[model samples]
Target: MSDIAAEFDFSMRSHGIALEMQQSNYLNNRICRPLVSAQATLVLESANADLLWDQLRRVAYVPGCSKRLAGTNWPDPQVVADELSAFISQAEVYYRAGEETSGPSAALQYYYSLLNLAKAELLLWRPDAIINQKLTHGVSAVHATGNFEDWRVKPQRGGVFPLLYEKRMGVPSSHLPGEINPDQLFSRCLESGMEYIQVRGKTLQAVPLYQTIVTDGTYSWSHLLIEGYGVIQQNKPSWDLVREIFEELPPLHHGNPWQVFALSSRLSLDSFALLIPCDGKYVRSGDGIHIGNLRLPEWEEELAARLRPMLGHPHGYFDGTLTVSLSDSEFVGLTSDLARYLSVYLVSSLIRYRPSALDLRLNPDQAWYLAAFTRQAALPALQSAANEILDNEFVFLDRVRG
Candidate 1:
């Protein structure tokens, strides 16, 4: 075996070996389940499109409801509320129509539904900026060749796309590339990750994240760790690679950036663990003050809140494992909301203008792949928009019938 591999093995075998096993079991059995269950209990559940539409419509008619729901106020609460209701009503029409149809026609209906929903959100948040102006789709197709993978979409400088980008990322859309590969967008989607892997035979852009708290009978600290070090090309995982991955992560709302530490000795090659020091202090040993006053459950809640922004709850359902990604050359840096929107936009555009191209894409062999995109993409987009509008992460629960 290589020296790097041997060092990694030894370190894994020796350093905190007992703690490592304890942490793993604790994370799997204790930490992950309750955190996900608690989140699930708090989210709004909807079994069908009608239920979802009703939930959203109720929020739309009330003045300053966005502020009340999400903690941010609209400038003209009544006007924005009225406009929001109208757009939502129209969006509901398209959404319902899309549900009843299939193929390219259904795709177009879903696109319009999402479009109106996006407009409602834009008006609610940026009333003065978009209320009276002529807004374009803000995104366009670069190439609509017969093959969908070969196609690309470009973001225009001015339009709803850039505005939404600015709203979500706090960065101007101009910073985005002149053109983006649809495949890259596909790779980042939580719903489409499996499809991406099946077709491309490569890992999705996201990395799985696991969390655990380690204690020595007196003092305890929470740690975030990622497996699958495929991002590190070399055998030895360098501090530089660790830092690069850390830097690519989205910034936390408050507090200092989490510190990266090697669980293994510096000489080790493969794996690493990151310490998210509570209150910005590294507690390597018992020298640091203990968290004796805080209950373990409370500490877990605190950690979940801190990491919520970076966590990807696949399809709005909190599975125990969350995901984060290292930005690569293929990544366009769009937020998940924007990625879903643009992805749907690309398909809708194809269906509308290039019917023959879409027909070719829906051939027997690839039909299931395209079907997955259609079936899975839109609901997340709506949920994301609703979250933005209400400033809350909402999950759909199936209605139980007696």
Candidate 2:
């Protein structure tokens, strides 16, 4: 939802009830009732939310899903993931350094990374998963960004010299997870678009827009600031072709069709976590903490700057939940929290109602044609459909491609 929801609609999202929509009465009495009922259910054959919680903990970060640990040792999924990712990452750093083509933990991070992708794969098949499937890793895009690889090449003794250190096996990680085949990714993205468009109430023959990965990562998306938004497939967005029309692009549109804020391996081996800067460049925020351009208000910029000093979060964007720990109330009160959360609701809804048109078998060429048309002005019907919900209207920010 970070930047992704900005592209679509969000007013329809809800978790039965979101934090922003919380009711005090429900929070106090209603919350405990579900716990009691779940616990009581365990009394018969199997109603152990605690046990569920335990096993789930082995994998998941959330609680109350099981019985055995329901009331005793409550651990936040957010915090647990944060801690586990860090613990595993630390174990990985040491293990990657010490161990080799031997046992487990060496590839634990690798497997964990793929495990995430596997989960995404499960979600992808679901009618609502945004990406039809997590783009399967094709060839390595390690050289694409030039930010990862050779993470820590420890020297090893070798050769004629008794104590001359030769470099050990280097780590191979990319600044972005673009090992994804674009042909497949763009195609599936359009499929998602078609379905999304239809959900807003539209039935056009097709939509053609230069699908861009303005920002892609494990937990964030910001396609709102994309230049190739209105691209047609036959006239695809290549760096060369884009150079010609780059001048004509809107302020929000970054030059290329794709602009990933991939997390570099300087952080971890999983992959570059992403943060699409609407502007082509990611501005430095000083110190070891680097951030790209976010469309936050000036006041928030000042706020983030002030908080940055007080908050010792090196992995602010990367390994949060562990560092800069926060209480449930504190996390709930965050501005970006609800927006980040809406993705969950969106995915669940997508799964429940597998809408047609979101089919992955979309034609990029045809989709681009629609993009060209919409660039001029919204087709009367398409515009109507996009705003069908009335209260939820598209916010194109500026006119004249400025």
Candidate 3:
């Protein structure tokens, strides 16, 4: 875990420079001063992680910026204390919801616990850094709020909306990408979804994070979803894949077919396009679909079918027993497992973390933004940090496959 923290620290330093967070020599001096000294201080204090994470669930709007842990010269420690208080206060809504899921947003309830935990960990370390606007934008902003795991929503592609979802009861769709058109598969899955989105970027790493979900002016439920196809392929996740899965969903009956949401991602600009390609000829406004993707039968089915069976070995992958059992506890374990994977991937991308390399200047505001900005820029290294923990397990899985 210390290794993970150290790597993330380096990642932020490298990224902070790249993003111009340390543009001034004064800022550079301030930011670089803390690295080695703060390492141990930052890593050992792990208490009530969930209590803090619960705050992010309250976020309603996309933030304009983000924070990272890159700066050396610590800003007002007093401000950090105040933000910590706010982070805890806001997270309470989700904590209370977790204790009782009576609201219409059961999906949100499920994610509330995990989102809080993530924030709590970060806030415990740097309260003020989480809110730095220069560090990130939109959904990234939401996560720092300590309100919801805003990281879960599929990234919007260039100002588009996507259909995000809650788990619904439906057989998994079997005829997805391997045989079916990937676009059609996505469309069919979201047919009955409540949240639709349009996006800009192309691909994203599949790691659960806080997401803000709203349509028009009304609030919609925010929950976790897969971000990268690579993650799905790697995990071989089980989801509903039944055809006509959307038939059971009730229409929103309020917003237009083009209602915009708060946490939706722009089209994927990354090398990987995590979502279906936008329909050009059918496209009028370059709209996004925000319908729920989590429980949509089409999505489950398509993903299931698209990810071919782990074959070439034996029928043991699916024996005649015909019964599958997975506990909430198991999923919790999976969530942790997946998070570590993503963190490691992010961490590995960091090559170096010196202020001189950053090549930027920082003012007060810029210093705060450095917290999240550099950390995100260093995601690949953090992701690698997470993966380092899994090397053994992956080898074991490969042996099983063999």
* Tens digits of lDDT, candidate 1, 93-158: 988887787754476888888888888777766777667778898889865465756789899988
Ranking by TM-score: 1, 3, 2
* Per-prediction TM-score: 0.67, 0.17, 0.22
Candidate closer to the true structure by TM-score (higher is better), 1 or 3: 1
* TM-score (C-alpha, index-matched) for candidate 1: 0.67
RMSD to the hidden true structure, all candidates: 10.1, 26.2, 26.4
Residue 122 shift from truth in candidate 2, angstroms: 14
Error of 2 at 66 (Å): 24
- Looking at model 2, report the run of 10 residues with the lowest lDDT sum: 160-169
Best candidate according to TM-score: 1
Per-residue lDDT tens digits for candidate 2, residues 294-383, read: 222222233234332111111111111111111212210111111111112222222223322122345343333223322211122122
Question: Whose TM-score is higher: candidate 1's or candidate 2's?
Answer: 1
lDDT of 3 by residue, 1-402 (tens): 122112222212211122322223212111101101111121222223242232232221223111322221246644544454454444456445534543122223323322333343344344444545223211111122211121122222211000010000112211111121112111111111112122211222122211112211111221112223233333223222111111111112212111111122343323221122111011112122222211123322333233222100001111000011122122111112222222221211111222221222422332222222322222221221111211110110111210
> By lDDT, is 1 or 3 better?
1
Q: In candidate 3, where is summed lDDT lowest over 10 consecutive residues?
A: 160-169
